[model samples]
Target: MTLHDDAVRVLKDWTAPDAPDGAQEQLRLDYLDHLVSHRDGLWRSCLPAHLTASAVVVDPVQGRVLLTLHPKVGRWLQMGGHCEPEDGTLAAAALREATEESGIPGLRLLGDGGGGPIPVRLDRHRVRCTGRGRPENVHLDVQYVALAPAGAEASISEESLDLRWFGYGALPELTDRSVRELVALARRTTG
Candidate 1:
């Protein structure tokens, strides 16, 4: 199946967590609708908005989470970016991004108790990664949680100015509320 098909399947099967008024449920439906209308919704060129996959790299054993100091956004955030042609599934995309950006090998995604990559959370945020001449973009992010190998050492990549682990309680002040919420959900999932 195509990556778009897989994304539709994953979202269909996922049960959004903590939907007090079905808010998360609404977002899920919106994403499904977006994909239905735009076959290219999964790629970078589909903007003014497109789907993105990301993961919170957590080393629960060490009580820490890895974040990148993004060069474009200039804030510490999770590892993720546009979907690629080689990405077979949304989960694979998230894992690939986490592995690539974290510079940590043997990294595995945290499942939703059913051994599935059902995202821990879904976040939509404005970003300037669309480039200089284009309009601003919205990343309808499918966020997952990835468990890093023991004693994982991070090396900075070109996408980030620095890579570092922060205590669960000590996330930098430079992050947005979405990141902070992602971390909190990840902590509850892993710890």
Candidate 2:
């Protein structure tokens, strides 16, 4: 199946985690609708909003997560970005971003224990995809958790100004609420 087709399938098949406000359910439906309505929804060029893939790399043994200081956003965030044409599936894209950004070999996305590589969370947020003075766009992020091999050491990439590991509870103050929530959800999912 094509990348678009894979995206549609994953969104349709995804079961959003419970939220008090039913926000996740609504967002899941909205993403599914976006894919159905906008054939170009998964690509970065898609206007207004587009799907992005991200993964939080967890070191189960060390109990820490690797985060990148995004150059443009200038905040502590997980490794992820636009899905590329070469990505065959949503899971593949997330894994690729984690591997490329973290520079940690043998990183593997955590699965549902039964179903393969299910996303742990979804975040919709406004971003300045373009440089300064350009109008912002929204990103529909499909988030997952990846496990770094024991003793894994991370190196910086061009995509990030800095890369470091933060304890599950010690996430830097620079991180926003979305990263906090995603890390919590990822931890619970891993447990």
Candidate 3:
């Protein structure tokens, strides 16, 4: 399926309520428990499980946060992607994504430069082909926080249809609840 098409599918899953039979709901709960139970050990092991990460870039002086409009997820998101084997560190991956997506060269490490094994909630979303024609099943992602140097020049990439900085009190019209929550979390930390 095309990235656009897969996105539509995931959105439907996210928004639509599944009035599944009681047994089915129980099954889902059981699966989720199993997934969580194994996730930590899995993360430490060499396995192609649903593992990924992202960075929350904040401009503290401006009291605003940086967000990217990802083509696949089709929503504004933290700068992040899959954790590749060769990545020296998770924080480095987040830094790489933040710079590549924003063209903001002077982002500074904040909080713990290294982040996670923090549990994150994943939502269904899609993205354009990073290069391949077929769309991929995107993972639910965990992200870390990095502070952007005040007055750093930043421009949005094609991966993002738009990019903007939003203050704690004022946020753009957005559909992703996780993005909003992250913004609020960053605001609390910064303030």
Candidate 4:
């Protein structure tokens, strides 16, 4: 199956805990429907809504997370970006982004205890038009958690202004709620 097919299958099969007022649950269903309705929905350039994969990278022993200072958003956020054709699964795409952004290898995804990547969180957020001549779009992000190897040192990439490991209790002020949610989920699952 192609990436789009895999996404459709994954989203359709994924079941999360109760979302407050069932809003998140409804969004998941809607995302699945959007995927089915738009053939190019899985691509980043599709506009309006597209698939993005990201991961909260943690060092389990240290109980800290690695965050990137995104150049465009100017926020300390998780490592992730648009899905590429080479990505075979959402988890793979997330892993790829984590590795690329963190400059860390040998990272392992925390599983949901069902032998699959743990679904840490889901977020739908808007992207600003950053001189790309494209209108603002919505990113339907699939978030996961990756455990970094001990002694893993991160090198800053062009996509980020800085990379740093923040202890859970000392997260930067710029770390958003979505990232905090993902980190909390990761801690619960990995611990």
Could you give candidate 4's per-residue lDDT for residues 10-127 as a string of tens digits?
A: 7877776566778667778888888988888878668778878899899989989999999999999999998898999888999999999999999988776776875666789899
Candidate 3 residues lying further than 4 Å off, grouped into runs, are: 1-49, 112-138
**Model 1: which residue pairs collide?**
none
lDDT of 4: 0.85
lDDT of each: 0.91, 0.91, 0.57, 0.85
lDDT of 3 by residue, 1-191 (tens): 43223222322332222445453344334334434554431132323234355777888888878888777556777887765444555455567778888789977555432432222223323443244674453343445567888697679887788888777677767637777866766667667
- Tell me model 1's lDDT, rounded to 2 decimals: 0.91
lDDT tens digits, residues 117-188, model 2?
A: 988889999998965898999999999999999899999999999999999999999999999998888777
**Worst 10-residue lDDT window, candidate 2:** 182-191
Of models 2 and 3, which has the larger lDDT? 2
> Which RMSD does model 2 reach against the true structure?
0.9
For residue 29, give model 2's deviation from the true position in Å. 0.5
Estimate, for each residue in 59-115, the C-alpha lDDT of model 1 and write its tens digit. 999899999999888999999988999999999999999999988999889886676
Model 2 regions more than 4 Å off:
none
**TM-score: the better of candidates 1 and 4:** 1
